[model samples]
Target: MSFTDFFAIDWSGQAVERPKGLAVAHARAGTEAPEIVDRAWSRQDVLEWLEQLARDGTRALIGLDLSPAFPFHDEGTYFPGWEASPVDGPALWQLVDELSADDPHLSATSFINHPHARRHFRQRGDCGDLFPPGRGRFRVCEHGQEAMRLSPYSCFNLVGASQVGKSSLTGMRVLHRLRSKLGLWPFDPMPETGPVLVEIYTALPARLAGMRKGISKIRDRETLDTLLAAFGSAPHRPLPRYDDHATDAMLSAAWLRVAAAQSELWSPTLLTPELACTEGWTFGVP
Candidate 1:
């Protein structure tokens, strides 16, 4: 089932007083007027709603004003840096794909695919299946608990100079698409665990339209930092508080780790035939 439609809702914690003041939007059909359930929903309430949708088999892209996955694990979970993280790209993406596959109409998307978010995942070695295998398509998962697959896909690790607005713009564009195509109004709930295809973009002084390089180019530290610092100064940046800090630290850490790893792999010796043949192999001795 394709999650082509959209829905949204305002989930601001306590600042909004009554649930009646809460706002929700579905693409077109839902109540013309806002629907309020007694009071504001807690995180558990939202999760339960999504669980029901998945059980019922809904196929739609459900947008939330909340951060589905956080960089830091709940309040006090220990996140040993990348060195101890067993998570690989395929493993993480597969989880997200499976978690939402059950809801034929219950799909999800977020505006948090910036370099910061990517870096944080790398630092903690804990990106929970953001990218799935097979040309941006996600697998369907009916079982709630299944082992994750480790398959590589065309994943985007958008790093570079700081404050470039990569996260905010990418997220906003996603929200815009969800609102436009899925008839998603704000303050709505999702009910499925199907696929959610995310689109990403970069921010820079020079135009980056039509540029298709490997993941290495986009995820460079200097470039990400330059962009991030610039975007932070922008008038409309909207990344969450916790995410903002986590992403920044992660991006910085990723660059350092890659640079160190690269240095360790370097060699001063030339690529001679002797070097070409590894030890313990009988080559050209016939």
Candidate 2:
């Protein structure tokens, strides 16, 4: 079944009162351009927006710029040497939800602050030494990403700008709440109707749009316009130099508008059952 709309979200994991980098964009069927749905959405704002869309029976394919699960298959589990590591993506998400049950508005501070799990992330200076040499950093999907020439950072690394740990951890809280309301790709089979959420890496679409490697962010209107035109989208108005969040969301939505129709994106030749069940595949990964 084809989706009636496409949506892409640029998520932020900052512990701010209101997230500034979060952006949302959408493209409806038959539209030549994708529009910015929300340029400054908070975590709670996005949750309510998605809930409303689900209630409205929107048949949309939602792409979130965050890892849905951590490195599991390579190490056999997320937490090495711990006997109680989650067995799969759903189990891991459930564990995060349970641990962060008391967090307000789906924030994952509780889980990130937990004594047992906090050591896995690199946010705290003392936690970096907890991980042994190089045993538990990447997942099978990440290895595939490397094969495709994309630099995939470990979700456990929360230090550098490329690190996705905080966002993925916070996204897990939202995913746990939305699991019953929306279909999560790879973990949950696509439903006949309603919204379906998939993990997306914006760099894939940016590269397809002719952006150079190591230059992931778009800072100029000309470059953004060229990227949009590659997807057959209409010309967009001028945007600021630092609006990478908006550019990522808009271009990703435009890319998904075309890519979602292809069966290869949904079922790649390399997608194994183990990878699909434990470490979820990025929707547009080759």
Candidate 3:
């Protein structure tokens, strides 16, 4: 079964109800450049939009810029030494949702502040006692990403500017709420008849677009359109101020449209049945 539409969501974990950092872009099954879905979006807005996709019977591949699960293969447990540490990806999502039940706007700040869960993540100045040493624990697929000369960070680190911990936890809330309504790749298997959401690392496409490390973020329409053209897509309409979030979304969407038929991406050498179930694979990491 082939996908007819491709969507890439640049998600944010800011405290606001509608994060300005959140952006969504769509690309159809052709060479036309993908366009950003211009609007301020709350996490709820994205959830509802995806629900609409299913209702409309859209055959799409949705990509979100976040890790679907924290590292599970390292040390054999997510929270290691903690009895309540989740054993797998879906359970981790459920645990984050349950712990962050009171967090407003589908956020995960509450989970970050939880006494038990709090002990596993690094904060602005405090390194959680449980956070692994020496660059932190990495999922098996992330090692594959590293093998390809792309940098991959631990989803457990929350302190630096590039940290994905908070955002990823917030994503878990969405995944938990979204799984019943739509198929989540790896975690739910590739559904034969519906949209499937997969974890995406924008750097993968940026590198493929000829971007170098430390300069992957694009801030101009000219450079972005240049990359789009390389993907066999047209130029996107210019935003008032170009940002990495929008560019990442646009580029990934276009690549998804062009690369969806590549069987190697679906069957990566590093991806295993256990990792598919315990630590979800990034869609383009092969």
Q: Each candidate's TM vs. the true structure?
A: 0.25, 0.93, 0.96
- Over the stretch 1-286, how does candidate 3's per-residue lDDT look in tens digits? 5999999999888877998889999999878889889888999999889999988878999999999897787677778777888878888999999998988999988889888877887788878887767788889988988987988888878877788887788889988887778888778857777788888988898889888777878999889988898789977787887888888999999988877888888888877888888898988888
| lDDT per model vs. reference | 0.27, 0.82, 0.86
- Please provide, for model 1 over 1-286, each residue's C-alpha lDDT reduced to its tens digit, 9 standing for 90 to 100: 2243333343332212232212333332221221122235443354455555445555534433322222222112112333432242222223333433442222322213223334332212444353323232111110100122122221132223222222222223323323312322111222234322211111111112222233223334344444333322211122222222222222222222222223321221222222221111001010
Task: State each model's C-alpha RMSD to the native.
Answer: 20.2, 1.9, 1.3
Which stretches of candidate 2 lie above 4 Å from their native place?
128-130, 134-136, 240-242
* Most accurate candidate by lDDT: 3
In model 2, residue pairs whose N, Cα or C atoms come closer than 3 Å (at least 3 residues apart or on different chains), thus clashing, are none
List the candidate numbers ranked by lDDT, top first.
3, 2, 1
Ten consecutive residues with minimal summed lDDT in candidate 2? Answer: 127-136
Query: How many backbone clashes can be found in candidate 3?
Result: 1
Candidate 1: where is the Cα deviation over 4 Å?
1-5, 11-24, 27-38, 66-81, 86-286
Which residue window of length 10 is worst by lDDT in model 3? Answer: 185-194
lDDT of 2 by residue, 1-286 (tens): 5889999999888877477778898888764778787445788888888998899999999999999999877677788766667998878888998998887656788887777787677775655555556533887767777787888888887777878888898888788778778878888888898899999988889988988888988877888889989988887755544488888998999999989888887887778888888888898876
